[model samples]
Target: MKTLKQLLADKPKTLAVAAPDDSVFQALCVMAEYNVGALLVLQDGKLVGIFSERDYARKQIRNQRSSKETPVRDLMSARVAYVGIDATLEECMSLMTEKRFRHLPVLDDQGQVLGILSIGDLVKETISAQQFLIGELERYITS
Candidate 1:
C-alpha cells in the first residue's frame, strides 16, 4: 500500500483552511467552493480543529444552532486524530474506521500540516491499486 506521503504527492497541492473565528457559514462556503467535505480549522497556520458536513448535521442543525452566527470552532471536531507523512494507507484506514471519522489531517515530521485525506480518497486509491494489479496478472497469464 502507498504511504500517506505518496498519496498526498499524487493529489493536488491545494489545501482548504478556515480560521477559528470564522462563521460556520463562511467555512461551509469554502468547503463548497473547494468541492471538499471538510476544512482544517487553522489558527496561526496551525491545525486547531476540523469542520465537516457531519459536524454541521449532527452538531449545528441538530442543536438548532445558526451557522451564520456560530463560529467554525464551535462546531469543529477539536480533538483531531492525525497521521504522519510516512503512515501507511492501511494504518490510516484502521484508525479512521475505529474512530468512525471520515477525514484525517496529514502532518509532516515537524508537525506541519501537509494535507487532509478522506475515506473516499483511501477507497479510490485502494481500488486503483487493485485494478492495476489485476491487469498485470492478466497480462502475465496471456504472455
Candidate 2:
C-alpha cells in the first residue's frame, strides 16, 4: 500500500510542459529531448491537457495532419487520467488500465502537479513490492 508520495520521494521530480498555445512540434521536441512519453499542457500555470506520443501517432501521423503547424490542443488528450499524492498504487493502476493511458499526471489537492508516472514506473514499483514481500515471508518462515 505504498503511496504516491513515497514513490515521488524515491524518484526525483521531472516535469515536461508546454504552453497551450505552443505548437505540437514544440511539445513533441520537449518530450523527445527529455526521453519521456508525455508532456503537460500548461496555461496560466494550470494543467490543461496532456500530449502523449500516442496522440502524435494517432492524431497527427495517422490522420495525415501536419505536426509542424498543428497545435497540441488539437492533438492532446484533454480528459487525462490523474492521481493525487495520497492516492494508493492500486488506484493509479486502475486508472491507467481503465483509461488505456500509459502516463498519468500526479497532482496535489490544489490541482498543482507533483510529478508524472509511466506504466514502466508502476511496473517497477510492483516488482519491488513483490520482492520485499517475498523476502519478508522468507524471513518469517526461517524464524
Candidate 3:
C-alpha cells in the first residue's frame, strides 16, 4: 500500500491556504486561482479549519450572506478530517468515504500541515496502482 508521503511527493508542493480573518470572497478567489475545491484555513500558520465550495454554498449562499463581508471562520468547516503522512491510501479512502469528505489535510507528527488530499487524487492513484499490478500479473502469466 502506498503511503500519503509518496502520494504527496507525486503532487504539486503548493498548499492552498486562507487566513481565518479573510473574507469568503477572498478564499473563493484563491480556490478559483488554484482550481481547487477547498483551502486550508490558517491563523498564524496553524491549521484551524477548511473552507470549501460546499461550505460556501451551504453557509453563505443559502443564508444569503455576503461573501465579501462574511469571514472564512464563519463559513469554514471547523471539525476537519485530517490524515498523517504515513497513513496508507486505503486508510484515507476509507476515512473520506465514511465522513463524506472530499478533501483531507495531511499533517505531520507536530500537527503541522504538509499537504491536502482530494478524493479525486486518491481514486486516480488507486486506479493507476491497480493498472500497474494487473499489467505485472498479465506479464507473469504470459511468461
Candidate 4:
C-alpha cells in the first residue's frame, strides 16, 4: 500500500489556498486555469473547507446563488473529510470513493494544509501501481 507521503513525493505539485472570502470567481478561474476540479479552502493558514465544481452546481447554480455575488466561503463544503500526509493512498481512495468527492487536501498533524490530491491523481497512482505489478508478474513468469 502506497502512502500519501509517497504520493506527494511522486507528484510535488499541489493546489492550495489561504483564504476563501476573496472571490468565488477567482477560485473558479484558478481551477479552470489549472484544469483542476477542486480548490482547498483555507482561512488564516488553516484548512477550513473545500470548493469543488460539484459544489458549484449543487450549492450555487441549482440553488440560484449568484456566482458573481457569492463567495467561496459561502458555498464551500465546510464538512470536508481530510487525511494526513502519512496516510495510505488506499485510504484516500476509499474516502473519496465513499464520499464521491474528487479532491482531498493532505494536512499536517497540527492541521496545517500541506497539499491537495484529486481523483485523477489517485487514478494515475493506481494505474502506475498496476503496471508495476504486471511487470513483476511478467518477469516472474519469464523466469
lDDT of 1 by residue, 35-116 (tens): 9999999998899999999999889866566889999988999999999887889999999999999999998888789999
Give the clash count for each candidate: 0, 0, 0, 0
Stretches of candidate 3 exceeding 4 Å from the true structure:
none
Best by lDDT: 1
Instruction: Kindly indicate the candidate among 2 and 4 with the higher TM-score.
Output: 2
Global lDDT of each candidate: 0.91, 0.85, 0.91, 0.81
**Clash count (model 4, backbone only):** 0
In candidate 3, position 135 carries an lDDT of 96
Which candidate model has the greater TM-score, 2 or 3? 3
Q: Each model's TM-score, in the order given?
A: 0.93, 0.91, 0.95, 0.89
Candidate 1: regions farther than 4 A off: 62-65
Candidate 3 TM-score, true structure as reference: 0.95
What tens digits encode model 2's per-residue C-alpha lDDT throughout 61-122? 65555777788899898887788888888888898898788998888889988888888888
RMSD per candidate (Å) reads 1.4, 1.6, 1.1, 1.8
lDDT of 4 by residue, 1-143 (tens): 46777777776466545267857778888888877788888787788888888888777765555676788888899998989888887888899999988888888999987788888988888898999999999999999
- Which residues of candidate 2, in runs, are more than 4 Å off? 62-65
Shift in Å, residue 114, candidate 4? 1.1
Better of 1 and 4 by TM-score: 1
Candidate 4's error at 124, in angstroms?
A: 1.1
